[model samples]
Target: MQSTQLSPRYRGLRLTALAAVASMLAACGSGGDDNGNGGKPNTKPAYIGAVTISSYDGATDDLLTAGLGKDGLASSTAPLPLNPAAPTAAELRRYAIYTNYRAIVDTSAGGGYGSLYGPNVDAQGNITASEGKVAGVEYVAYSDDGSGQQNVTMLVQIPTTFNTTQPCLITATSSGSRGVYGAIGTGEWGLKRGCAVAYTDKGTGAAPHDLDTDTVALIDGTRTTRAAAGKNAHFAAPAGATSLAEFTAANPHRLAFKHAHSQRNPEKDWGKFTLQAVEFALWAINDRFGAVSANGTRQRTLDQDKVLVIASSVSNGGGAAVAAAEQDAGGLIDGVAVAEPNLNMPPNTGIVVRRGAAQVAASGLTLYDYTTTANLLQHCAGRATALTQAPFYTNPTMAPFFAARCQTLAEKGLVTGANTDQQSASALQALRAAGWEAESDDLHPSLAAFDVAAAISVTYANAYARASVTDRLCGYSFAATLTDLKPAAIAPAPLASMYATGNGIPPQAPVQLINDRDPQHGPYLNLPSVSASTQRADINYDGASCLRNLLTGSDAAALALQAGQGLTLRNGNLRGKPALIVHGRSDALLPVNHTSRPYLGLNRQQEGVTSKLSYVEVENAQHFDAFIGVVPGYSNRYVPLHVYLNRALDAVYDNLTAGRALPPSQVVRTTPRGGTFNTPAPALLPSNVPPFAATPAPGNAITVTANTVQVPD
Candidate 1:
């Protein structure tokens, strides 16, 4: 690890900048004459709305841990708000930090929380007993147009230890559809290195508009009526051709998530939002540290030339970082480091991905294409004998549903089989043919049990189609469900704390995916609802198939969705910025074949010899680090991908700051901390998760030639 200390020259420059800022403030306070030009103060960016600034002392309240510190973060339970009915903005902020932090990171001691990576672990990888509490000032605002319809939240955290002379910035675009704090775990890497971390929700957040209650969330996670919030609302259901009152009356208890119903096709602007976040961070930093000019306007003390900026995050946020790098026409981004990015490859790229001598069956498919397919087949696939050892596979209660799904698939000719057993095998094979690797076999059962595929498919399909909440695209509606699995009004407490707890996508706690087309049982939860076509509890097969058909269907709605998917596709040109991408080979949700592998080929095709992208595929590591500690058998079979993500960040930072050679593209074979199933695995050690090598062994090297990416088998 590189030293965090500033050199003598940098220290002197920091002192000079501080002195200049002090002199300028004193002059302004004394109403002194302008040094040169007319007296004018620095102006905030036009896109930025009312800024909210708060300071933390690193004791009672702090940025990284939200006053909980390292120990508090390691606890199994999060601190709750004093008033469940209504949480204060401060309480919501703290809860957001805590929830988002644990969402990405494995907090269990056996999962390497304190040892490999955590608040207590320094950038230098040293284990410290001290609670890692960073004293910093937080600046938050909405990066919006005049309409406020696209009020993408942007936040900047500048730790007191930030080096003024050798300035650095890191972008942490929110992963998945989470709120601004979604990538807080990734931001910790930059914070520990004394770099300013810029975060954006990328136009998708956890602020669900309760259509029934006429309420919406604000930028600060506080709730208010849509009429009261006015242009300040984070998200408000557009009236469209019908009024809100009419829509609510017709679709009572239905909720509208910004990602699914904003009708903005927000994914298309993820990169723009991420770049805007960097701009916001730069402006905030300049506002604080820049020296006043002759006209009393704060001069640009830090910029692209003076500051080193790295685009980084994970999952959807990671994808946003890559997108930002591709769209960085202004040269704002210096490098990129991310893990398991949700990349959507352009059509007809002619980029082939191969493992050893065999070409991948399917590659470069969009998120909706693969996710909807998974939603259709994963339940049936979970019953395959190959996945018998998978977690959640042996539950007797779910077995009938899995069997029913296989029967339905077979009857529909989606799979050819004589019995449920054979149908399951066919379904599992279908998933592999669709791009999933054998390593992903064990993950399907648990992922299916959690409705991961259904939630993603429904959300993405609605988003791509730009459908309204009232449309309930594919007959799927998000709402609270009663004991009988029927739609019900959401409780006030959950609605109030949703901004801090909801993971944007529905089927989250307190919000269930309701099957509106279930004729046998009106508007019931998807899992227990009987499919209208099959008349069986096949996990809402009708809805899943409908979502899948959007890719190939030629209807107007399908055409619109296809158009929106096109707008989100990446050109893969990084403009020559050095970048590092690490993805788990066992990532079932966003398979490596469809994402990073093909993305590497696409980048090479676009940039050719000038491309500085390196891909690291880690074996035995999957998406969702939180699962490693909580899900049975996950800890014994899979290592935390978060460790490798940090390593990649470190490597990228070293390459930028010290001109160190970035690690070569390779397959990092990691060993899982194996133990008895359902029992906690042994404490993680360095050997369990090895670092990517600068010069990987011959068998592990990943090679790209003529826009063809080949990974070692």
Candidate 2:
């Protein structure tokens, strides 16, 4: 769980956001004039400016250029002589937000967060977002919140066709910048698909979308075109939702949220600002995208087409609350899905925080608070020990919708009472205070014992062991004799744990070259100067980012597809759509254990709603690499990314005219790992060759695991 950032879903937003212009129409503006009954209703929603606007679809090139020039005050026609610095109605209409980055190295002899690989990240490029043909610009925007905070940013091409009836998703700055990451938006999956995208600075990259990426001067009157932030008043959490922390900063409207990662964290003064964006989105969509009123007190009603809610979860706390509010609003969201949301976990490891509806909520536990498992361990332990329980809002369940999948996780070995990192963090303290720990079988588990989330966060170069255990592979071992042991033929094998092996789904290929231990590549980066913590920041830390949003398989994906205007078919049996679950077998961070059940449960929850759910095990893949390398469909470019692109686009076009829901029944297949060893590999003695010789191979394998990492730590 190394706080996986919300990338795939962030990409999911691009598809959904295609309809931003149509969906964000200001339903009806209140004239504030007394109607037949004191407070009267007006004609259409009151127009905001002197000239009425049908929508912000970049109708004129002048408007686009205005926001970029004229000393930040590029005044435009209508709308109060627009200040280009502010997010334009069109820019906002076509905006896409997420964590995206290109690797950048601190070349000053010896400095921060070492290099990506042996070569400095800068040497690689100023940007590495993804390899698609789409153009992108990066920047850093400074907000005069009067807080002395300077914001860095990155903007990318978030193209949208006019009047296309589609759903759109949004994310806060989970990564520092360059999209959601840094350098450039090269690591993204959507840009490859040409989705119009936008982002804040995840790192020191150029600002493509920002009106003021290169200079101190912002778009003049930029503040004017922007929506003023809500006051920093204290607000209570809703009934079912949890109240995580409080802050003094006003909520970050969509524009402000674009700069969320610009300032460093661990300080309230360093508040996250996107929560407001979430609330505004809820209000905007319900009011126009679907058929709902803008007033917070009105009933929610969506179009027959389902709408999806997606977030990065990195700076997702505020966004989570907004999503919850929208889902609860009744009809706005047919399905609510977040990538990795932790609405109220003790994030920041140990940073004690106040509850602020205005401040953005980061996704994971921090150095100040507990880690993922530890936070959950506290929750579970709290349930077991407390005589009087707090209400859901008060005791406040974080990620309850998703956490409910815990039972499924327990069925697999993904979740264990004792080994959870959080449980381990509190081990000794619990023992000393409560007489004994909570697990039915204590094992007097180490308070800091290796928990799946914590372990995976630090590095994929881990050895899964139970103390003194010398070797561990997902679920395979090297053959005593290498019959197919040729160097060119080596491949990864599927895992075979009892539950994972037997669970119904797609059958997976067995690893060709079974190894005696886990892959190790940390040292290969050639920077003894870097540590796991540093690695976590540059490439790991997803705890806070992904927590902003997540929705598990089937139902979640279905919701996303609907929002994006994709298709689904109902299988005959009437069971939930069966999914061919796929994950990296040797994955160290979000270990296969934690992933299995939630995946299986998704299939179950959609039972009677879908049909024929299944699972597949990718032998040696990591997280994000699935689509990048191979594994078409699930992670492959063939299935969903490219092969399915035109089909998905067609689906969007069809939905705009007719009210046709997606096909409920479907079949999905996850690709096998890149290599396919015919049999197995011969054991190699610590040869006379350099130890580093075999190391790069493991590093190559590490990319798959980087799929959902959180923003720059």
Candidate 3:
């Protein structure tokens, strides 16, 4: 998660870096009332003046499109007037509470994270670094909060050459502070093919230490520690509803949970923050085009219409891309490329997350609803032990049982031989103590032993594994040779014990006692009041209600947004634009179904234009693996998923501009290492399988006219 900075690949283009020009200060005034509540404006509105290009060497306008000459390129509009009524820039700026603008040139040594890759890759997948320029333009904007000013900086990169014969594409990377730089570096590959890239800070990417606090301020206006954070906050059990206490009472063997990750923003402002970043880039395109056109650097202008918003995420940011597009409704977005996107669906809406109102009433683990067997399974060995320890696994009964089971497994030789029982117990005790001792102690070190012990215990505890004696747990068993259970055609198949354990909730776990719960956690959850097989499934609306009570004075809109209904900057709906979605079948953060569910929902509602959307489930892929490279030095079992994703993006561009028929929805098959994909691949598993079958079938490719789903085997 590197900061969004332009790679040194732009060294060649810096000679033309814009020079500093005398900036004219516009008188400050409250732009307008943007609260939408129809109330008087609370704070002074932000003022935005005409963007001034401080320096322009104009060494070569080859990067400029030929339609508009580079000379005299200036903003089509004048500096927004100081009057309170001027709302264009003011309205946009309100989304981000920045109040100041400064003009300056930031030159990097042309080195950073981008240097790790062999060479810059072009959009066409060619390895080259010839025509790109990375330059920083200090964009200073003051916050009306009186916190002074914040630098809403942007890194602008352009290929020194352009396919001037056609409109040049401008790609904006708004992947946030840590991710923006990496995305820019990746997007710079497009520079070889005459694309311009802009990276803008959404003012939301705060340092880790500040992330929670900053996010709280940005969205909720401030952060508050709930007094009842660790206390049971659920209400009295509702009649006919299965409460947590009831479930536990019925199954005393269930684990008692200690709730955590409780910090939540009652204000759903991250969506607006992301949208603001996109808007800033749009503004920059106009500003740069105007600067180049005014300076007469080239005879053409960059294609504004051809601009596209590209975002790839395995976390909240993943949802942001779709949210932004849906909110903008193709107004600012033409197409979207999302990989394992974590769309902002409200809690308790899906099978994996729902809890009865009364069930929720009896627990402090509202956020803990996100943890499931499938998700925790992704945390292997050392990582896996974290699931059993304190905050995450505070299940009082289960924790000791899991720990004892791990000890028994070590004694029985059913566990990995990497550690003895004494060693594993020693490590486990240390981990548990750390949970009770310090919050910041890195628990990852003790996890491997913990997971090893837990794996053995969990396996032995599960009735399904009663007949097995196992070797070391492996994570790659999903792609393993069925005959020998060895890594199939891939080097260094990491142990697949995790995959072998299966994704079912283990026996003795409280999840097993629940009849209506999906072992795969997500926004979807069946109300305990209803049977799991009942078609009357609904999200736990009470999750939002509970959160509202926790954050007294919080606007209900935030909860609604989280619940997947309130209006926000991003609507999550695609407006009949060419779109490509890729999700890893094994994504731990956001399951593969997240992608399919949204596609089907839109197909049902949009009533047509199914051809506009293409979804691919990459076999054996994980949530982040498709976009972010494999974790550090680990040998990846799956192909470089991004290679396929970039190709999909290329197809999206063609569908948008050339009227080419988009590819059908299909599964992206993986070949052995070093294999190349000449065509879109099919799935290793059919849709009739458990996860897919659990939901309505979405057939192979979506039918455009009928808006019907087709899931081809």
Candidate 4:
């Protein structure tokens, strides 16, 4: 570990600068006013709204585990609200932490929860009996303009153990369209390391607008009517072409998610929101720990120059970290460490990605491009005879729909085959040709079975297109469904608790993805809804095709979506910050071929030798560690990717704080915890997931020369 003390020379200079600023403020009559009558006007960023501050004791109400502690977090069942219909903000915060923590981590002890990485596991990788709670002060606010449309949630958690002398900050942007607590598991690393962790939803969260009741979620996860919530509402459906009442009456029981219906193309601002969160964190730290003059004015105790800030997270949040690094004009970020980031590489980068001896057929595609393609073909691909042995392949309920999807693809000439098996094989081949690696094949069945592709495609299409909920883009709407699969009123309990439980994307329990264009069933759950043209329950193939068309089509809406995608592209520059990205080669959701691999290549191209980015490709690891414990086959085949993320963060922190060298870009061939498919695998051992080698063997090294990235088999 590095010493948390500044060099004497640097400290002297910083103090001199602070004294000069203090003198100037005093001369201007703004030096000593704690009541906001003066004193430099509360240096809070203009973008940040009113802040809510709360304190917690490590034992009962704490920051990291939300008082659940390590044991409670690892438990299968999460604590629920006493009053489900109206959960208090405190209860919702606890529930959000529990759900979001478990959502990304493999909590089972057999999966390495206790031994490898959990609250009980200390920063040094030693197992301890402690519950791992940290006393802290939390600051929450909305990063929004006056309209309140872009109420991106910002939160800062400063632990009592935080080292103010050698201050460190980590950004934990919310992952997977989840709420503010979405990356709580990732934030644990920084919290345990005595760093203040800054979090932001990046303008996308679990806040849903119940259009029927005109109710919206607030920043604290409490519900109120849109009219009453006013500017504090997390999200409310904007006035569309038709009045709110008329639209609600026409499309009753529908819900509008902030990510999909905010009409802000929030993904474009993810990097900005992440930076804003850091800004908020700085402000909070200064306000809490700054020096107080005799006149009671708070003076700056920490600034960007004095703090070691690392932009870090996983999945979408990881992408945001990278973006923040690229857009960091103020030199706020010192380093970056992320895992399986969903990065969007700019088109026509002239960067080539090669794995083993073969050049990849496709690289650097946008999220919607591949996600929409997966949505269209994955179900059909799941029917391939080769994938029959894949995990979650024996689904009696969805097997018929998979077959129907194959038939539909064959009829549309999207796939060529005389039989369902052949067409399914062709669809699977299409995915591989379009950038998905062969390692992703086994996970397709499970992802498609869980409606992962469809849910993401629908949500992202609307988000990128900036479509209003009233548009029902691609014939899809979010709503509660009856047992009969018909659209129904969203239950009060689910709606109220959605901020804690619902991922922004629909098909989240009661909030199902509704296919409004289902001619036969008339607004039903997308899984069983019939396509009008084919009159078959082909898992809403028509809607999937429409979303895919948005990527390839030249129509007005498609053009709008394409334009929105343009706004989310990363420039591939980390501004010379030392960064490490670890990605699972088997990640089905955000394939490395389109994400980390290409981004690495692009970064090298953009920065040349000045780039300090290292990419670690981990084999036998897939996205979604949460699936490892409960999802039968996952336990046997995949090690927790979360462990690698922690290792990456540790390496980056050491590099930034102690001037250590980062591990060379390499492929880490992880061994899976192989065992029976349905039973829990043997306990995860350190040998299964090795630490990064200081000098990787030639075969494992990932090399980048000029604009090309080459990975060994």
Evaluated at residue 309, the lDDT of candidate 2 is 30
Candidate 1 regions exceeding 4 Å error are 1-42
Candidate 1 per-residue C-alpha lDDT over 462-522 given as tens digits, one digit per residue, 9 for 90 to 100: 8898988877788998999878888889999989999999899988899999999998988
In Å, residue 5's CA in model 1 sits off its true spot by: 21
Ranking by lDDT: 1, 4, 3, 2
- Candidate 2 structure, TM-score to reference: 0.30
Candidate 2 yields a Cα-based lDDT of 0.23
- Which pairs clash in the backbone of model 4? none
Model 1 RMSD in Å is: 3.4
TM-score for each model: 0.95, 0.30, 0.45, 0.95
The digit string of per-residue lDDT tens for model 3 on 276-348 reads 5544444443343322223222211222343444443323444555665566643655566655555533333
Q: What is the Å distance of residue 8 in model 3 from its true position?
A: 35
Residue 254 accuracy (lDDT) in model 1: 85
Candidate 2 on 240-278: residue-level lDDT in tens?
Answer: 111111111111000011111122221121112232223
lDDT of all predictions, in order shown? 0.88, 0.23, 0.31, 0.87
